[model samples]
Target: MLSRPSGGAVMKYGFPSLSNIRTRESYVSSYDPRTRTPAWVIERLGGDTLGGNADRKRCDFKEDDRSDACVRECAGVSVCVCVCARVRAACTQVSACVRPCSVHVFHRATNGDYRGSGLDRGHMAAAANHKWSQKAMDDTFYLTNVAPQNPHMNQNAWNNLEKLCRSLTKLYANVYVCTGPLYLPRQEADGKLYVHYQVLGTNHIAVPTHFFKVLVLERDGRQGGVELRSYVLPNEPVDEKIPLERFLVPIETIERASGLLFLPNIVRTSGGAVTAAANK
Candidate 1:
């Protein structure tokens, strides 16, 4: 059972569970808005790591605080990662408009960034996952959390994957998710695939060729072990009819491509027992 800090009530299966260790990354921001130096970063709040701690640090959102969700803004890349816990009871349908984060100028994205680009304002941290509160839901509308994604892929395959994440709340005590962009390699006429991607606007906002989602699920009971799932999807239009199972990939694959680690402590606790399902 997972216990809520606010209510102090034990729930059989909770939406956001505690993590054994912090999962935020430390990097150098090359942008000029804030001090361009090395710093620790946390994208949003409401995940397994709620408050600021020694290991996990939070970013300053300057003026665009929504008071509902947390944000980790990468001014250098002009993209932000959003984190939140999905509670079925607090989930509400709310219509919100997309806007810019008024914080450190280049730290976030803007509407003009995607103006003529043949791409959708892809969300790194999905909006629907935060249906628990209208403010949390609206917090997702910030341009900083979006990337230039192929319209078809964003609306179809990616949407299905988000739905699957939400469904896991019913089976696990807590579900912690980390979503981000990937600039991967692609094959050309010569058959040699090269790593390359595009950027948009004056800020040079990166348009990832692929996106990744890493999910950590804690079982409902004391003996329930941790499970890790990772996926990488192309930024192109995918056939909606394709089964989502086709995208299941090994966590190592993501770690290798993104240069980030997920659930490092839990991975050691399970003795590396978390195996990737064979992509069928």
Candidate 2:
């Protein structure tokens, strides 16, 4: 039998950064307020967590309602109002109506930002991985868990990568997948490397230059061990015909590029035959 790890435990692994940590039903993530996207998201996938009566059609991409804008009123006077990026204009109107309107703003991307931005709201945590429960699937739709992605990339090659993660569940007893974005530097004409990317909407949601997925496959039964695989793809259209193995990269490469450490946690938690074909 598979030794079950907590579904979405905070202590399960070392996160890239400790800022703005949030846990959902199926995944644990760290939000980057500056970029308005998740720094990283980790989810556990097993046979039991694969299928259920969950309907994706019922789910919609939305702001993190758990921490939405709020206004505090004391003695029939509005004391403070914290507004989201999308409703800053409305907050201005409220401020005008109140004598001591103190407005503080929190940054979060909204659906309207992506409405005509020509970029898809790519999911850091794939929705299909949390089909075991509707709530789990719904959690994946939160805007905080998404980043700007090329439409073609999101629907084609990127989709294939997500499928590969699910397929691994059949081979291993469990699969722990960590997905996130990377801002790689490029050489400029002046012989210096620079990092640049587009920002969408009024919130200035950053579009990652590339994305990464690192998988930890747990071996089943008496012979307990784990295997590691990591892959990175650009945030643009890629030919679907290319084999995924071509995108396979060493775990350390992802660690350096995305500022995330995975091997240490794997060694600490699963003390056994840990091997990685990707590094070979």
Candidate 3:
């Protein structure tokens, strides 16, 4: 388990897992070592938190290797080894450097892995939502906060969805977004349900078959009223013409699919009734 951060505002409603939790400048994430991706990422958004000169163009996706050594090591390893250099006087110079390096290794997805994979490094906690600071925007680029997403969907539908989240700040006082990946089981021709997804690169980062985002929208204030809207989108290309509301699903559906609970009771305790979007 990683140490919790100073501010608890980002995780106002609580998260799914207690293990492997990491705190960032703009968001909180639970790292999944096995998948080399975030299990879930939660962030709070509002008009104030969205205004800044942070440039996404200046940010680059990097391995989050500064946290717990175990988590960093699990991402990959860099080991210093002996190097032999030929000398001009019939003698060779040998240098032996025995040090631990964790720049890039297996069991973690590097930027190179997505180079030809036809998949985009989709952000779970969108960078645009964290324009409050450059560090915040930079943290969202961490590989742990990303997942493999279809290029078409990532650039089209998914990008639109992210824009919608940012746009919601105008209407709502506070918007808490929880996003993650889901690997749903599908029934094959043999009539057996199986969970199957592709693995990318030498690290074999598991590609999620579906992705989910749950929005906790505060009407007036934190104690005002709350409305929940949950969505699930397939990993493949989705028609950009389709309405986002078409993918709206009950919060319970997401809970069952991702094994993560969004505490509705806590939202209700904010002195307002908690309502979820009607199931479609």
Candidate 4:
């Protein structure tokens, strides 16, 4: 069994197990040694979503040198999830050294993947949220934890949402955050909405049309009931003036779209709620 953090009741966070996933296509879960918990799980998909070449790639390194290199199964990263908590110390500045995964090749994003691609190497597990330790924050930089994200969306609205998660720590004992990419539908000239998104790099990394953040707050200490909040933001540039509540959607919406289940052990009565104060 995994050891729980000291000084608090054991609270569950991060991606649930594969048994909990209803849709099993292109999904894998792994435990992160640094965080001592489930690092992140992803639902890999092809470039067109019609199922073409979305499979993982094998490591090209030799046997003797293979230990330090990314393995064959790390290529097709679609979405990633990680539990986030606020740290007591001020957030540190770490150089953005985006590297490929040594264990799972398709599971991680490469530094060259985002080069000249216009999209930012957006972190599914925002580094600032894990300032509790250098390793915790460093683990978040792994390519598997990132997806191609619009710079406007990542820097502005998405950044705001990250801040909101950090702020909740002041009110709750810990904040459980699950972030991932979404491929949503859009209406076209024919008035029909179709699910479409771009793929980046030779590995065909899927660029999500939108992103989601699901926050579970452990209020009144870990013993108290939890509060849930889920938000879905477009991958495009969002107006900075728009309130974060505008992106709020029922958790059911995310479950249906992402094929991932959350907060199954906890009792949830209604959709999660978010206040404007959280934006500040």
Which candidate number maximizes lDDT? 3
TM-score of 4: 0.65
Candidate 3: residue pairs that collide: 78-101
Clashes of each: 6, 0, 1, 10
* lDDT, candidate 2, at 142: 86
RMSD of each: 12.5, 9.4, 12.2, 13.9
- lDDT tens per residue, model 1, 1-280: 2212221111211212231111112100111122111111112223332322222112222223333333333222322111222332243542222213223454445576667988887666565554444444444444545567898999999999987877777777666566767677879999998988777766566777788776766665664566777778998888878787778787778767766655534523332226322111
Candidate 1 Cα outliers beyond 4 Å, as residue runs:
1-103, 189-193, 268-280
Candidates' lDDT values, in order? 0.51, 0.74, 0.76, 0.54
Candidate 3 lDDT:
0.76
Off by over 4 Å in 3: 1-6, 66-106, 264-280
TM-score head-to-head 2 vs 4, winner: 2
- Indicate the residue-level lDDT of 190 in model 3: 100
Candidate 1: count the clashes.
6
Which is superior by lDDT, 3 or 4? 3
lDDT of 4 by residue, 1-280 (tens): 2122321122243244432111111222343322212233432111112112222232111111114233333334222221122321233532221122333343334566567899887776665544343433454555556677899999999999987876776676656666776677889999998998787765566778888877777665335666778899999999999999999898889887876776566655666563212111
lDDT of 4 at 138: 52
